[model samples]
Target: EYLHFNLFKENKDTFEANTIITRLLGLRTGASSVTFAGTKDKRGVTVQRACLRCVDHERLATVNQRLQGIRLGTFAYAKEPLRLGQLKGNRFTIIVRQIQPTAAAATLAGDALRAALQKRVIDEFAEKGFVNYFGMQRFGTRDIGTHQAGILMLAGQWQETINLIMAPKSGESATITAARAQWAEHHDAKAALAMGFSSLYGSAERALLQWYARHPELRHDPHAALFSALPRNLRTMYLHAYQSWIWNQIVSIRLDRYGPTARKGDLVLVDPAVDDVDDELVSAVDAASAAPKEDADAVPRVAVRALTAEEAAQTSMFDVVVPKPGWNVTYPDFLLPHYQSLMAQHQLDPLDMRRKWHECSLPGDYRHVLGRPRDVTVAFQRYTDPQRPLVPTDLDQITEAPTKFRAAPAPFQALPDVGPYDALILGFTLGTSQYATVALREIVEAD
Candidate 1:
């Protein structure tokens, strides 16, 4: 049996936190033994369900005592393991502080006017939804982004791909950056592994370097072998990020040409029972690729069709669909030309996306061009100390901590105190693959 626990973390990414827990439990298999519904942001406190297979409960009790930034609670045994995108949806309580308007929006700067504008935005988003563009976080902060590595992988530039993955970036410590620079200059796997990089962010590089050190024979041409040595999920992330980039470009074009309104050749989901579109319901079927072979039957099969000009008139923004760029997906007739042009810029052919590497071969999937947030609520508050938290986290409520409602020092609190700053607390539920950051972008009108 597996043990399920509610994981609460502040200022830690889901992957990094899971790695620490894995090591603490002495799980030699590492990340393969742990599972979570979805990844959460590292900047804020987030509560989510996670599971570890065949774990000793006694060891889990020590985690709370040992870990500083993480908390584990409400443990239970379950028959099944938690998989990515397995949850119905995520409930978020996000706090946006130091509210200020842009030059364009500065004319209406009073509290009442700002409140009215926010209300209008929330109401419009609730009804028609905002553009479901991939957030900036999907691509890494480096000049050579994750999607660029994906492009290189697909194009069979293995050396270039590995170089991109191991390249050093800004904001890293001198030692870590030096290690990466050493690898770049010498390509000496044994030398790089000897230096050691046990940091949370250095796991991928360490794994790849270790593989090369063990198999010195493959060091001369270690692209395919090196790529294969890494975990499946990590490889999949690169391809997914590339697909997301293409989807973002295509969706932006579609929205610019046809806002909210469905076009003649736009694609929409069709259920056998309901001949027309099901605009009100968001299905949990977009995560087909994320599911394992054992869970194939659990994924629901969704059918889609191109809308006729007459049928298009009856549909709403939720009815429009965009292809995630793969060999298996069908692009909307109206957007096919745009997809071809965009793919050509990267020397890729969207018509035939098959690659020799299984990780690079994307089968494609469909996602709604727009996503609506459910059970949404917005409230404004005035706070004296910016270091204090405006919303209570799940751990606070679970532990019944007296400080739940009181002002406490928090991590990563950098909001300057321009006295009497307004804090916007938003409570909403969003389905899997939907970005809360993107939703916030719509509310704040941020670039």
Candidate 2:
């Protein structure tokens, strides 16, 4: 080893709290960062450890189980004699680069990106994974963090307030602001995968491409305030179910969330549980349009009036049936503990869970190891949320019939030909040592 050579810390950890306003500030006060010191080798030496912990989920045993499983694979077993190497023992010199970001101006901007990322990720995960709005069980987990982070990054500083106002519509719509805030989210997902779960990888990849499909010009919706003001939880559920039943009974895809472009319509005030939410929206839009105005010169509006606070408080998209997972549901099996375990063991640390969604475990972790390693370099990606592919729509632009879905289609790539092209004549030679090597790899990888 050279004495005078300069060195740099390869693995740098970064994060930003993704919560409502007050919580974000709390993070700047060191809500997520903490130091823990434990004895080394059962001797009188003190060791310093810096760790990230979610205060909300900390006390929850489920959450603790999750964190411990992660630490085992990443720090304690990430090297050596394979099985016993579940954590990286004593290789890395702990260096903490901590910063607190405060930018209230970016609130609106951050939300837009979050929603867009959520929709694309959820939609693509369900479409490419199991049918019928599957959940985390499908192949999406691996990239959830990365995909979310990537979306945040892609959002960056909006060119204008309009861009911020028009960002995508989903849970992520407001999760963050400033594209630079994504690194933390990206690493979180990557960390999950490294610990041993990769089932979510497929879902994450599809989400990445789906988000790519939208141009930044398509960010806002005039009707967003109306939707945002909608109610939550069970109230939204009953209304959504009724809407889905009606829309599905008529249209093809469930239209609980279609825009005026996709749903040309009228406006009306009616109970969502009784009246179909889709039809009610349609009627409301129509009535609002046809309502006589005092001045003929008055500018026409894109969306109608906002729901009363009472009405808004009653509107939600999540359902009670959610997560009731039936038999064979992939719950804790593929994405959690195991995936996290592997990452911990492999010393595969994700750089930023909030940004750079496409990168696997951070670049540095791949190089240094202090334990017995497993097979995965990155966990598989797979997860699903039914509330995906949401497009923001302006209330004024509702001329009926979505001009949105008419965009150019994505390119499709076909896999190479497989199996024997002939019957018995060619088949006999095919399995006989010729394709044995190929078959062997498939068997190994598929499991």
Candidate 3:
């Protein structure tokens, strides 16, 4: 049986949210039984659907009551589990705050000028879609070393991966910073093992340390042992992050080659159910590889095929799809040079990506070259600082008012005077695997 819940999470990642719910339900099957369409941002308030197996109403209620920073809005039983990329799209209501007029227009009139600028930006986005670049969140915020570690892992450099994972970053906690410093200074298995036992070290780091402590003789071939010690999800993530980085580079190159449009040799993705034998084989292989590890009963598949001259004529109606490099994945002839150059730059061969560990192997996937937001609407409003009095100009009069006036202030206080700052409220919807943050970047031009 499948159970669905409306998850409202604030400042929490999807993994942490799932972990909380799994613990609250007291399900022996653990987190693997729960599934979600996609992950939401950790720093924002997001509402999305999630599913679990063999959960009842009572347990769900207990979960809602026990969990903090997450509230269940709706609950129902489903005949099937919610698989990844199952959603049609997500609706976003984002408030862009601290907006200021451009320097050229700063001297112009008050709110009107800011509002016009905001509208112009929104209109530009509506006319031309934003660059579909992967946001920085895909990499670690503090370290930004996941892709580097992934590169090392793929190259069979185990010690380097360990170093990258345990290295000290600028804003780490005191304990972590000190532990990493000790590891960096000594570079000894025994010392690192001792440090990893500390409460500050995460499970993956501790696992590596424990492996080193257990098998000191295998120091020369530590890559295999050290990598095997990490959790399966983490190992998979390392490879996935590397693939994402490669895809990002390729997308940048594609934009340079074909400016905002597709050509005859370009590739486009369509529904996998197309009556093509090659597409079916790709779907089957991806499903077989991913289903067991991800506990996904059903996997969604799409076909990535090169556009013919006839198809390219209507390219604007479809999205250009690029392959996430893998051992078995095929690429169009036109893009082969670019792919080869990128792989050469990283000193990697496609054959080397094949791994004995199935979880770490790439199952081959496709991502669109351009992401366009749908049903976009924007509104502008004057922002006011709530801290000071509603009218800073009238502060002296309020302070000097009579004792009776001070004793009982007016119930309906005047609205705060509008400040120079303006806020932009943007509403839009994006399909699965698309990021709202990426779309917002086109307007704000911030990282």
Candidate 4:
């Protein structure tokens, strides 16, 4: 039986949450036994559905007892496990704090100006949808973004991929930084393996180093070996990150040229029954090559067409789709040139993505060019500090006052101080692939 439950996570990403759950259950099952709909931000309080295969209520209850900053509830059984992007959407309650007006405007209107500006920002977002650039979280927190590493992998530059993975990025843990530094100086797999990593954070790096130690004969071809040692999900992530980056650039360019509205040659979704010539070619290749079929259904499919003049006008009501370029996907007529140019800039061809050796081949899909938050509502409230304030200036000299304060504060306690600042509380619902932070960025210009 597949067990489904509502999972509440705080300050953890999906991967971390899964790791914690795995440890709590102490199940010998592999990662595939657990599944989730979509990943949540590492820094937020998020609630989502998750599933564990062949687990019982008593076992789950025991697991729940050991967990902190995570809660599981509303358990049920289902025939199938939860899959990524399988949910309708996510609901969010976000608070934007320390809101204030610009200095120039504040001089003219004071506190009232801050409220006016905040209201205007919300009103504008509710009326006009924001550009759907994949946020920085998608690229990762590293200074050298994950997409850059993905580009190298797609180019069949495995050595470069290994180098990038081993190199230290800003904000990495001390253990990771030291290990990378040692690897950089010597380029000796044996020595690198000997140097123990003190933290569990460098699993991928450790895996790569261990692979190098075991297969010293393939030192010249470390990239292929290194890629093989990495987890399947992580290898796939490289390609996905690259695809997302390309989509972001295309959307930015389109918005700069044509605004948010759709135009002739823009993409519109078509019935999936319609035959896709490109996908058929890919299927033929896969079948003839005898590639694994277990993951075939997970491959993304492109089923869209260019919009005509009349159809383009209706884009405001319909979704405007952009291709996440893959070997089996066809580019829109108007945007094809842009797509080709971008690929060429990266020194890559679309056919180059068919890397069956690593099983990292991408079957591209489509994402909306604009994301509008649904059920959006906003409110303002004075910011208050809940913590006790610093001791009053004369408290040290007033011993009698302290005794009286301690004795008289049974039911008539004074409230905490309220600060001058105000906060904007935004509540909204967005589709599975959409990001609430993206909408927030449109209003607050958040980094």
Ranking of predictions according to lDDT: 1, 4, 3, 2
**TM-score of model number 3:** 0.74
Task: State each candidate's clash count.
Answer: 0, 107, 0, 0
- Model 2, range 302-386, lDDT digits (tens) per residue? 2222234355345332110111111111112212233334334423212222222111111110000001111211111111322
lDDT of all predictions: 0.72, 0.22, 0.65, 0.66
Candidate 3 lDDT (Cα, 0 to 1): 0.65
Model 2 ranges with Cα > 4 A deviation: 1-57, 60-62, 66-232, 252-447
lDDT for each residue of candidate 1 in 339-391, tens digit (9 for 90 to 100): 99998998998998866554566667777788888888877777788777666
Give me the runs in candidate 3 sitting further than 4 Å from their true place.
23-30, 63-68, 103-111, 181-203, 206-231, 270-288, 291-314, 350-353, 386-420
> For residues 1-447, what per-residue lDDT tens digits would candidate 4 score against the true structure?
799987777766776677668766776543445789777767667778889988885577566557777766667899998876466677777766667655546653435765676566667676676766677778777687778878987777888888887777788666667777888987776666666542232245766776777777777886667566675556666767888899888888888877768899887668633323111112222222234656554544546778899988866722677777776666777677788899899997654567645355566766777667778877655546624322221122221222311332223234333566566667777766567777777777566
Q: Who wins the lDDT comparison?
A: 1
CA error at residue 161 for candidate 4, angstroms? 1.3
lDDT of 2 at 177: 26
lDDT of 1 at 340: 90
On TM-score, the stronger of 2 and 4 is 4
